[model samples]
Target chain A: MAHTIANKQKITARVRRIVGQLNGIERAIESEVSCSAVLQQVAAARGALGGLFEELLEDHLRQHVAGAHLSDADRQAGAEELLALIRRYAR
Target chain B: MAHTIANKQKITARVRRIVGQLNGIERAIESEVSCSAVLQQVAAARGALGGLFEELLEDHLRQHVAGAHLSDADRQAGAEELLALIRRYAR
Candidate 1:
C-alpha cells in the first residue's frame, strides 16, 4: 500500500511505454534493421525498464526500510537483500 | 493491476524483511562491530535488496513488455531502461 502510494502513476505510465517499446523491437527484428540500430534501440529499452525498477526500489526503502514494522534482524536482512540486488542487477 | 497480480505478496514480504535488515545495520554500526564484519553485513544487505529489484524487474518485463498492450518503441525503451539499471546498480 505504501509502496503503491509512492509510484503507482509513474510505474503505470512507464510500463505502458515499455510495452510499446517491445513492439518496436519486434518490428526491428522482423524488418532486419542494421545491427547497430537494433542494438541501440534494445539498449534504450533496457535503460527505461531499469529506471522504473530503481524508482520502485527506492520507494520500498523509504517505506519499509525506514518504517517501524520490523525487528533489527529483519531490517538487517532486508538491507542485505537490497544491497545484494543492487550489486547484482545494477552491475 | 497486472503487475500487482504478479508480485503483490512477495513484494510486501520482502519489504518487511528489508526493514528489519536496516535496523540491524544501524545496530552493528552503533556497537562498533569489526569493519570486515560490518562490510560483510553491508554486502549481504545490498545483495538481498538487489535481488528483490531483480525479481520485480523481471515481473515488470513479463507483464508489460511481453504483453499485447504496447508498441515497438515503448518496449525497446523499457528493455534499455532495465539493462541500464542492472549495469548501474549491479556494479
Candidate 2:
C-alpha cells in the first residue's frame, strides 16, 4: 500500500539502528564480554525489531486489511487476504 | 526477560488474530479471490507479521537490552546480546 511505500524510509532508519546494535554485539562477543551483559543487549535488539514489526502490522491494518473506505465485499476480501498472510508468517 | 514472559499472553492474542486473518486468506485463494483483492490482503498480512516482529523487538529492548537497573558493564553486555539478535534477524 501507499502508506508502507511512503514509510519505507522511516522503517529503514529504525532497522539501521538495530543493525548498528547488532554489530556492536558481535564485537562484544569477540571480546568475550560477560554472559549476562551480552544477554541484555540481545534482549534490547529483540525489542527494537519487535517495535518495527508492530509498526508494519498497524499500517497493514489501517491501510490494507482494514481500509476504512472499502465496501463490505471488499472488506471481507481483505480479511481473507490478511488471514492468509498470518498463516504463512506464523509457521 | 520477565517483561516478555509477563506479556506473553497479550502478544499471543494479537498473534491469534493475525492467524485468523491468514486462514481467511487461504479460503479466499481456494475460492479464487480476484488478484487485486488477493493482493490487498497479502499486503495486509505482510503488515500484520511485521507488527508482530516489532512487538517482540520492543519487549526485547525494554526488558533486556536497555534495562533500567543494569550496571554499565552489564548494560554493555546486554548491547552485545541485542546486536547478535539483530544480525541474526537481519540475515
Candidate 3:
C-alpha cells in the first residue's frame, strides 16, 4: 500500500523491535529465566505484533477498500480480501 | 515453572519459528513486497505468538493456580499474576 511505503520507516522500526523482543525470549529460555518472566516477554512481543497488524489493516482498508477513487467492484474485492485475512488471523 | 522446563524444547522451537517469521516480514519490507503479502506474514507471526502464549498460560494455570496441591494463598497469587499478564497482553 502507498500508505505503507509512506510509513515505511515507522513500520520497519516497529518490526525491528518485535524481532528484538522475540530474540529476547530465546535468550531468556537459553539462560533458564523464570517462566513468568519469559511469559511476560512473549506477551509483550505478541502485543507488538498485534499493533503492526492493526496498522497495516487500517492502511489497507483506507487505501484499497474505502478509497474515494475505487470502483464498486474494486471496493468489493478489497473487502473480500480483507475479510479473508481477518478470518485467517482470527483462526 | 517446572512445566516450562519440562517443555523447554517445544517452547524454544516455537519461539524460533516466530523469530523466523518476523525476519521474513523485515525481508518483505526491504524488498518492497506487496502490502497484502506483508500483512499476511504479520498475521501469521501474530497467530503463532498467540499460540505460544496460550500454551504457556495453560501450563501456568494447571501447575500454579489450579494444581491440586497448591495452597489457597498460592493459588490466589497465581491467578492474580495471570490476570495481570492478561491485562497487559490485551492492552
Give the candidate number with the greatest DockQ.
Answer: 3
Q: Please, what are the lDDT tens digits per residue for candidate 1 over residues A11-82? A: 788899999998998999999999899899999899888777777665554444433454545544545555
Question: Which window of ten consecutive residues has the lowest lDDT sum in model 2 chain B?
Answer: B1-10
Q: Per-residue lDDT for B1-91 in model 1, tens only?
A: 2235476787899988988887898899999999898888888888788778777765655444433444555544544555466556444
Off by over 4 Å in 1: A1-6, A68-74, B1-91
Model 2: DockQ score? 0.04
Write model 2 residue lDDT over A22-44, tens digit each, in one string: 56655655565544444455556
Against the true structure, candidate 1 reaches a TM-score of 0.43
Candidate 3 residue lDDT tens string, B1-91 = 3334337888899898888898889888888887778888999899889889888888888888898998888788888878987887777
lDDT, residue A72, model 3: 93
Chain B alone, TM-score, model 2 = 0.76
In model 3, the clashing pairs are none
Task: Give lDDT tens digits, candidate 3, residues A49-68.
Answer: 88889889888899888889
Candidate 2 structure quality by residue, lDDT tens digits, B1-91: 2222325446446545655554555555455554344445545654665555556566656766687887787667656656776665554
Ranking by TM-score: 3, 2, 1
Place model 1 in a CAPRI quality band. Answer: incorrect
Ten contiguous residues minimizing lDDT sum, candidate 2 chain A = A1-10
**Model 3 lDDT, full chain set:** 0.83
